[model samples]
Target: MLVLPAVVAALSIIFAVLTVGINFNLIHSIFIRKSLNKSKSLTLFYLRFVIDGFLGLQNAIMSTFILLKFLEVEYDEPVEFLFWISWTSMNCFNVRGILVIVISLDRTLAVFMPISYHNFRRRIRNFYLAIIPLSWPIVNNIVLWGVCQFRVNIPPGCVIFTCQMNQCYISYALSFEVVSHAIIALTSLILAVKLFIWNHCTQKGPKSRDLERANYLALIDTLIIIIFDIVPAGFTVKFPALSAQFGSLILVCKMSGYALESWLVRRALKRTNDIVSVSYANNSSMIKSTGQASSNHRHHRHINNHAWQ
Candidate 1:
């Protein structure tokens, strides 16, 4: 049973690496880079990109730690310190959740208000947006550090679990998760409603099609985040003794979301390329038709000149 967690942790590490790779690729892509030049929404997405990257790295390291501890890998470090580090990382998962909420809100504004979204300055938004996501992690770490220091008892060899800890830690953490999940769920619902409304109100032209596609992608991503947060965290709260197992389950869902997002990005990029190709072909055909029309007009003029002569 212990080995099951270790195996899941290994798979988590692999997917976390994939998540990091895809996020970095997105950061470097032409669209993102161009957005850096053109859009305030880029700042929001850059924050999301950073948050996702941090989550991936955090998951990888913590999962590795979990695996090593499960295998009873020898380490000179004190058990208390190991426990502190692992649980602190686990608590910081709230920061990731809150960031998703920020992302959902930011995207909501962008999608619903094109005029305001485009007019917004990146500098102003970036400062505030950066503070929002960054602050939660700092506050979460502090609270987590305080709780673990004051509440937890560390067994000599096992860093992952100890016999006794105050209920405050679980209660506080669970409340945070539940509240964050509710907000995300609400945001997802709002986005879905707006998406449907937008589709119905708009004509089925290229512009509307593009907007629908973007909205649907954002809607799906938000839903995935909600699912990953709610299910495993709910189980963890319900079965605190099996937190390690539930944590592993959460990591699995996180990795699955990462994989799904990567696929979405690839699909979006492919669609963009296809649209551009079709546009280019249309332009080329139009130009060819214009040129042939001109050539025929010239040929007719030449025939009239010969007949007049």
Candidate 2:
């Protein structure tokens, strides 16, 4: 009993912090400093990053409340808000995953239809605009949950062997979660394979080497994320429904995944810096050589002209 509440509380905190660090602390405040930035800035990234940022903030706020409840930090839950937040958080997360799925789809399209992808690339703003309406159904469900305060009656007060963590409800949520995850995993896997084949068969240039490295990085990232998120989230509340100490194992896993993603992103960015530096060095040397050649040519021309005169 003590452990379950604490575990829930801790996950609430972890995810809440993830929401803040990823969105407000980094993307919104530090990154989104441009007025009309579109798809270029890490903030925009074809509008994908910014949208994730927005969703992150919402997730963070919702997570904070859940953590607060677990702490028994009473804010007078009308039962309605609990229902709203519970469903909203889950749904919004799903929507966020969809955004990532779209990014995967975009990458696939880039590979399969390079010319057509470029044509639509400029209108990423439209892509973001389109995702907004798609979230309404999720939002509506949350609102309805709140309005109804539909709390599951599980031995009243505190949950025991009795649980609001009901099987049927869990099944419904898992069915949806697994299906979405499966779709994402399937699509990304196929794309990765196809990408590998193309990379193998195609040119072996410098750009291609960087691409191959990025592919390996991306593959690692996809697998890590898929493992963490393939939820029967009730699983969080059910199986290892162990104490926070026990959940520590899973917590470490989550942190490792986050760290890995961070490392991969930095590695990806580092390659860009290295390329830029090398390009600059090459350009500098070229300019210097050209200047020396010009000076020598001019000097020779003057001497020859003097001699001729």
Best by lDDT: 1
TM-score of each predicted structure versus truth? 0.73, 0.65
For residue 270, what is the lDDT in candidate 1? Answer: 56
Q: Pairing residues by index, what is the TM-score of model 2?
A: 0.65
lDDT of 2: 0.52
Off by over 4 Å in 1: 31-43, 77-92, 109-127, 141-170, 200-210, 240-247, 288-292, 295-309
lDDT for model 1 comes to: 0.66
- Pairs in clash, predicted candidate 2: 39-46
lDDT of 2 at 178: 66
lDDT of 2 by residue, 144-216 (tens): 3454344555342332211334454455555665676676687779878888777688836555434344345
Q: List the residue pairs that clash in candidate 1.
A: none
What local lDDT score does residue 196 receive in model 1, on the 0 to 100 scale? 72
